[model samples]
Target: MARSYEANLETSDELAAVNEMLSAIGESPVNTIEGDSNADVANCRRILNAVNTEVQSMGWTFNIEEDAILTPDVFSKLIIWLPDYLSVKAPSGTTVYVNRGGYLYDRNAKTDEFTQPVTVSLIRLKGFEEMPTQFRTYIIAKAARRFNIRFFGAAEIEASLQLEEQDAWARVQEFELEYGAFNMLDGDAWVAGRLTR
Candidate 1:
């Protein structure tokens, strides 16, 4: 006999976040974005996008590596093709330099010749769905707080929402610390060290 297990699929990250925001203000969850009569789904999506942008700006350990061909010329600089590239990590076997524009330059100007593509590791901002649970909670709290402010426009509610947002962010920080996530300073140093050399 073969053993079998059942798995339950949950709502999508966007729907969950929107529902979380709705539940925060004592509203019922909806089945679909378009079917949500109580909330503006488009506006919720915009809020979620904003929250993702803000959270990503804070920097996290989310990253990916890719091989990119260096644009070899007299300038000795290489431009990364990844549009979402945030910062570059130290690559193997060679000293690479990265600029604010995500361009990589060989530290040794004489070694500009590249016969093959070089692998570059980068720290990039994750999409909303790619965020960890704690980060998603933080995003929901922030989105809720913003939604409350926009929908209610009541000073008392604003104060409470602010507190909720703060608490949510605190939880996210705690989770990050618990999981040994990268600190902003550490990431900065890693990049800065390579750039200076």
Candidate 2:
């Protein structure tokens, strides 16, 4: 016999996040994007895009796995253009190195005859539905702050939203630290380790 259980999941979508931002700014919630000519909806969409961009720039723990075929050539460089590729987390094996420009470098110095698929894990922006509760809240606060500054131009509201944004960011930092998503070491740390030994 197969075991069965009921699960209660809290899921959010793009419209939900948008509505959250709108509600934060004292606006009514929108049902759908279709046939909606409200400026608030447009602004919400723009803010959502900006929020995703900002979050991706921060490089969170959310990632997607992809494979790119290494083009065998004289230079032994592979051009990988994965959709929405932010940064390569790691390659499948130790033989490959991700260059500064997101290109793959074959450390083994393979010749032009080497043609194989390289598996890569990369950091990417999560879809609205996939975002965690903390991230959604952060996006709402950040979007509201941006929207308020651009349209309302009220100092008092802007200040309040700024504080909200700061608090949301602090929560993001805490979550990242707890989940090991924050990178604590850099190149200098490697040099320091060598000196201590």
Candidate 3:
């Protein structure tokens, strides 16, 4: 049968991404994402998720929430369930916060309790579908490169995949530069000090 050369208009999904990874390692694409009974498919899915989480943890503007308020639970005033934040901190203060036992902990205050609502700036984890297209492409390319290296370890193929990975990374960086609106004042201690005034 002849394969059509039609362009795909839809954006890449988890299945597509996994298939890309599988293809990188000289494996056939799977019909479904999970429970494929193929060890290679399972490995691809795992690598994809791990790569997604790692990339999101880099704190892109898309995943960052500013001045988000997190209130304590009414039933358990002392236990505030923390969001899946990659890194979290007070919007502006010396106060440091950490995720401890899936709860928000005040490192500076030495307490896990919050009497009042806390405003924070955090980079939260977003699902694969929630990620921007540029980031998604980058994650898939990176994952494919890693999978190829882990399984096949072919020097020539790795070199080719590395080029793709680097190209994808450059695209992601370009997207960030255009949309992130980053300035020197971002996360500046001096600028944060002024917010207190």
Candidate 4:
């Protein structure tokens, strides 16, 4: 089968944003309720209803309202709602809030943060320790599965004995890229080897 899965750089930024939001949620207040318990429950129901509207727009269905626990406002513009995915209970004398791997709404805060679907391929590279861990991991994974290529260690050594300044391997040279000999020294250390299943 042909390798159809390509590593998407755009998704890296998206994942980073998602992670940042998760961090923000972890720090910020989740929920606060004034008035009686009935009003608090109403607020949760409203938040969940709004969440349904938001999540459905992104092609996902959720039960945030039914699963959230209400809490007193510890901080302004915050209402914590734990998602169902997390098996947590309400704190003592406080409501529990959950929104698993997804978005939650804060009516007072006027924000609705969400979790999105993301995918990535990790690559691994030998010889060139300078290669990015993620890029190398992706390359290695792709190589193993797609190329069925087995080889020796790889060395990105400069063929030209020139006094380099600033950096090495700046330009992608043909001969500069060298592969190691199979069974060269150790079992590992292949220049551009990738395994497939």
Question: TM-scores, in order shown?
Answer: 0.59, 0.66, 0.83, 0.14
Regions more than 4 Å wrong, model 2: 1-12, 64-80, 89-114, 119-121, 181-188
lDDT for each residue of candidate 2 in 33-141, tens digit (9 for 90 to 100): 6556999877877777777667765667554444533343446544544345555533544454445354555446642233555555555555565666677778778
Model 3's alpha-carbon lDDT is 0.78
Q: lDDT (CA) for every model shown? A: 0.62, 0.63, 0.78, 0.27
Tens digits of per-residue lDDT for model 4, 1-197: 53211122223332332232222223222232233254323332333233223322221112112233433344343333323222222322132223433434433334543232111111111121233333233322222221111121122211111212112223212112332122533434353243321
The global Cα lDDT (0 to 1) of model 1 is: 0.62
Query: Each model's number of backbone clashes?
Result: 0, 0, 0, 31
lDDT of 4 at 184: 31
Question: Which residue segments of model 1 deviate by more than 4 Å?
Answer: 1-11, 34-39, 63-80, 86-121, 181-197
The predictions' CA RMSDs to the true structure, in order, are 9.2, 8.3, 7.6, 25.0
Could you give me the TM-score of model 2 versus the true structure? 0.66
| Residues 81-115, model 3: lDDT tens digits | 44456778887746778878878899998888888
User: Candidate order by TM-score, highest to lowest?
Assistant: 3, 2, 1, 4
Q: After superposition, how far is residue 110 of candidate 4 from its true place, in Å?
A: 34
